[model samples]
Target: MERIIGLIDMDCFYAQVEQRDKPELWGKPVIVVQHSRRGVQGGILAVSYEARGFGVKRGMTVAEAKQLCPDLATCLVPIGEYADKADIQKYRNASAEVFDVLNNFDSNIVVEKASVDEAFLDLSIYVDNIIEKFKEGVDLILPEFLPSSHIADGHDKNENDDERISRISTFLESSQNDISLLRLAIAALTIEQIRKQIRDKTQFFCSAGIANNKMMAKLVCARHKPRQQTIVPFKYVREILKTTPIRDVRGFGGKMGQKIQERLNIMTMGEILSIDFNKVVESFPDEHEWLLSVAEGYDSEPVKARSESSSIAVSKNFPGRNAINMVQELRQWLDGLTKELAKRLVTDQLQNKRTAENLVFALATEDGRPQKTLKLVSYHPDILIDMLWKAIKPLNKASDEQTWHPKIYNLYLGATKFVPGIPTANRDITEWLNSKGKKSSDEPLTDEIVFVHEEKKVYCPQPSTSRSDSVIVLDDDDDDEKEVPITEDDEEYIEVDGKRFSKTVFKNLPVMLRKQYEHKIALETARKLKMNAKSSRKRGNSLVAAEQSHMKKHKPLTSFFRKK
Candidate 1:
């Protein structure tokens, strides 16, 4: 099906809303602006059609607008005041009424609110259902063009004045079935129905367009006056766009459209469409697909409502060079932004539990050059702040004696990684330590273990000739149970039949001495296991007696005969 997209633009929305509340401003040039110095001069937020005729435009200062039309009437925009709770509720209520009316046509209709005033509606399905209603046959009749000499204003007439009037009368009398007239009548009736419904329900006036695509529809909608609609047939798409400037197309704005004009030397949409698609793509790499689609008069992209997960970012423009104070200012700004983001996350029921994958820091140069640096940060806010500070410290502390100190104008921060918070089996030890009064540098082992095992063992590795070198005999074993002299390197010792031996030689000792050494090792291992498993009601597998007995059975008598 040929897509029928409608761009419904409210004519001077703010101005109309103001005028509707205050009926005295009807049919007069009204401009909404901000009160400032130089006798109320700021961007023109909205301008009535009457004001637009007198060279008024949005973003034009009130002073400049007045210079263009000296008698222009002005009013301050109430958005800042009306953006409050009560007023926003009213605005939303009005918007809901508008949507409710549009929804009656088709539940499948896509409605996108471009702003308070403008919206794009995908009416392809709705149009398809009503196609039969507009299929009636009609004849085309062109209006007769009168010559200059035959027309007169207040001045005296020429000899052809009566002939011109007679021709116009005859043409009007002969043709009662002009196709343009019939089409316009149908369009007017349809638009009037919508307009009446909106005004009665919401007290707002909206202008609509009817065409096969968005671009032509938007253009036609703007062509007509307030509270009116215009229909562009599918056959007239080529002709209508032939002379339309490239900048006039929706989505073509500012530097993008200007670049296209400069590079392609094409002033109108028709000229752009006539060029090779590949050349257009090469010229505008960033918007190649969009330019090509517009040129072909085909757009399939659907309008969708905004989603929260799409983006969450914060940015600021600084005043001067990278001075010492700049770092403090940046930190302050980041704190404010983080606080706001945290509030929003809570409101949306989202968690910030995982580390952010991308942390971008954009730097705007004095000479219009763009440079940026990026780093990764942990999910914890404190850790993220520390990471950002470390990354920016070098730039913030650059010496004045070096190259030019480039003023930092812009900074941006964002988080790309998101993880849902779910309960897990393993708890993060570092996180738990940080939560308590303990520092991350604290040792994992107990103080007693460190002092007894580590400190005593280091001093036990010294030679002492005064100590006895005799080997002791064991009671349970024969001559094989003889004890070996303790060496300076051996710290552990075991007794066998009144004989002492180092654990290093316990394997060579008699059976009685080996069994005695094994028992000591088993006791020490079990003690450690009990400490670790204190919180568990069920005994840990590591504390099983079977495992301890296996180790005890392999100890050697000669190895256990050494002494410390």
Candidate 2:
């Protein structure tokens, strides 16, 4: 059976959400920004089409945007503002509503959300059902592209929606058994319905592309802007790919595209397809199969539904002179980011019942240095802070001759590697191993044998021993049946025959040794600190002494010449 896929992308998602909430802002330039009371201009997150006309773009400062279009409107989203408020939540809710609409379209609809603004839908099931209905002699009225107010303003006003639909429908209906053309027609009709439903309920505009696979669907979705749909016929696939840059394809946009351009000296899919398939396989050994499939415009990848994000990150950028210089400033950002992550983790735990195990902290410096990352086990807030401080300690310290402080410009904290299932009743095996097979400190061992190796003797708890039993000693097998002998000494000792043994059990040795080792470690740490301080002082003194000696050696030549 032929497959039909569609990628539906919401236009200017964040800006559109703001405009939808405020009807008065319709058709006006809008830019969404992070709110700050510090009078700093936040970078643009998203901008409306009207704003784009004025040369405004994402990642530009609010000041630059305002300078371009003084009449521009800005929506400020507060970061870490309140428990009940968030800018992302608004967009997330809008995306959820869009997905809900898609889900209600068909009982077997396969929808995969690509982002907060776009999704991929496998419309093959719907199209097959439509074909069956048509075979049953149900009058299949071809759908007309709906006339939308959100259409690009410069689109030909003379174009009629019904005429356009009739022309394409008539062309496809001319060949009844051409499954490819029929599939394209049915897919286009389905997309038209989806767009209409989305706009009617969400007051938002979207564009869609219908193709045989996701790669082509996503690439062609951008062919039409703001409330339009395009269908790529299988016969014309070569023609479309001939002129399209290889980098414009989804997976080819990264370094792989550069490598292809460098090695094959080709920049488009048409040129790539001309290369021998064996050569293509040889060049990209790892991705050979995928490379060949995509080059031939045959993508067999499936659309996977992601009900929740794999990882959640919160980051803040400090540009130019606003770079972080002090430990306190870094700590402040960490505190805020941690709070954000904590909130997100709590929400995920409640909704998905998944707990993240790894906390990744990354920082980029402004001193022409490389970015550094540290991974730690996700712990409570207090322990997390200590770990963060230790991770950043190198940046906080100074060198011997001069204070070398790094200026950090970007800070990020993310949690990943989520373990599914609820946190309760989820105990790890390592904990049991270290705890000698006990469920927890409060639980009894119960039918479990714990092997404690101490002082060349193996000890096993007797089955009759109760939960409150402590470590006890047993005599050797040679004299097991007879009573053991005792030795007279300051320390407790037991003697069997001629041999003597200490009465100190492994569990009872803590009083004599634990604190002693701890004190030794403390002393070693203190000695290292003192040595570093003394070395620093010695270097300072040597530098001063060398300067004074140089001054004495370079005595004035005038004095030796008996000044004229």
Candidate 3:
């Protein structure tokens, strides 16, 4: 079966996301830049077409962008304010939503996420199924919302609607291009419908390129920009690649292309195709056959659905004067970054049910070479930071030996080599086999207390209690429960590794954690029950008093007549 692949690329994805969320930014020149003060020091993330008209491009510093287009709008800042921080979450969320729409289009539609803003769809099966259904006398219905078409094959969009319809009919009826035209037409219409659905659902516009393979599809997809698509026919494949430079080809643009040009003296796709297949194979043993196939505009690669990330990375940039110098500053930044990393690790643990087995840290400093370190199974930031210090200590000593001040600009922390944790449901079986209890390292420490009390009183620490007063001596089996005295002013406390927590704090903890404070939990629960009973009795007495007062205030008329 002939292959049909489509590449859908969102236009200025990050900027488009901002525009979709903030309608007022519509039709304006919006630029999305990385987080930084004065914005220009950090790199630009995306640029709107409106901003492009003013010569603003991606990767330009905010300062350079501002010089090119003074009216450029940054997604990080309000319309009138200065841009400071780059919020990347909105773009990430938008891309996921778009992928969801593509994923559910059809079960047979094999979609591959190319990047945050681009994806490839193998619609051969979907189109084949549709065509088969259509040929069986089933009436085909076109979507009510059709995307505006960009003129393909030298066709003029200004031409009359009737003339366009006539051309389509003639192409469909012609015997020479009948099957190809019908297939292309069906694929085109389906892609158009899908694009419309994406726009309707995501409120973001995208462009697509449909061809026989990924390489050609990606190359042709960019022919028309913003909101348009181009369908490259199989017959015109050679014609399209004839004048293109070898460097313009996907694989040819990298080191492979330079090698082919330098060693093979080949500079164009046409030249490479004209060369002997044996000569090419002998010269580039591993990539020889693949190179020839790509040169011929043929790719057999399938579009496979993307899986969850194997690694998670978090990094922070300290540009220009913002670079880290002092040890105190490094400590502060490390604390914040580790806290954030730990939070994300916990979240991923809950959602993905996977644990990272390796921690990698990279720091770019004045030395030009990044200080790097890799350790095993350090998920918590606090634990990972210790490993990080061991890695950086050598770098610090080297810098000290040189007697030069080190200015660190970039810090990278990545969790990789994911290992599936013992499944929550099957953990009991695994534990029984290993004869291991639950790991204490997995528990999160309560660094900051978030008190949620009904009385809304701020917890105040009293004078320190002696060991004798605080310690509650308990027998292994005590028939009589000794009540620990806790005044309204006196808070119940439990000491763990010398850290204290009140009974109120224990009560508010999750069930898993409540068990850890078993002694205090039991007492807290009983006290709450007693307090509730007392409150309920007070309400009952108040209700009876109100009824008696009402009866005395208005006596029954029959009772008054009998008494007289």
Q: Judged by lDDT, which candidate is best?
A: 2
Instruction: List residue ranges in candidate 3 displaced over 4 A.
Output: 37-41, 77-87, 135-181, 264-268, 275-285, 316-334, 348-355, 363-378, 391-410, 418-564
Q: Give the per-residue lDDT digits (tens) of candidate 2, residues 217-281.
A: 88777776767766676656666777779899888888989998887788897677788878877
Per-candidate local distance difference test: 0.49, 0.62, 0.61
Q: Please state the error at residue 58 of candidate 3 in Å.
A: 2.2
TM-score of 3: 0.64
What does candidate 3's lDDT look like per residue over 27-102, in tens digits?
Answer: 9999976665453445677899999999999888787888988888876622111112343534555686788789
lDDT of 1 by residue, 1-564 (tens): 456566667767777766775788888888977533224355676798889899899888778889988888887643221111011222333454466565553455566665556667765554333334434532322222211111111121223446545543443333345433233323333444555566765567778776666676676676544665555555455666667788887766677788888988898866777878789878987887777667655556676642124344555445444321444555665555443332232222212222234555555556453434454433334555666666655664336433323555655666554444311221111332123325344533110000001211111111111122222332332423344454454556665333345654444332322433354456456656664564254464444553464445333212222221
Error of 2 at 133 (Å): 5.1
Error of 3 at 225 (Å): 1.5
**TM-score per candidate, chains pooled:** 0.49, 0.64, 0.64
- The C-alpha RMSD in Å for every predicted model, in order, reads 30.3, 28.7, 18.2
Flag regions of model 1 displaced more than 4 Å: 17-28, 34-41, 68-105, 130-192, 254-256, 273-293, 305-564
Tally clashes: model 1: 16
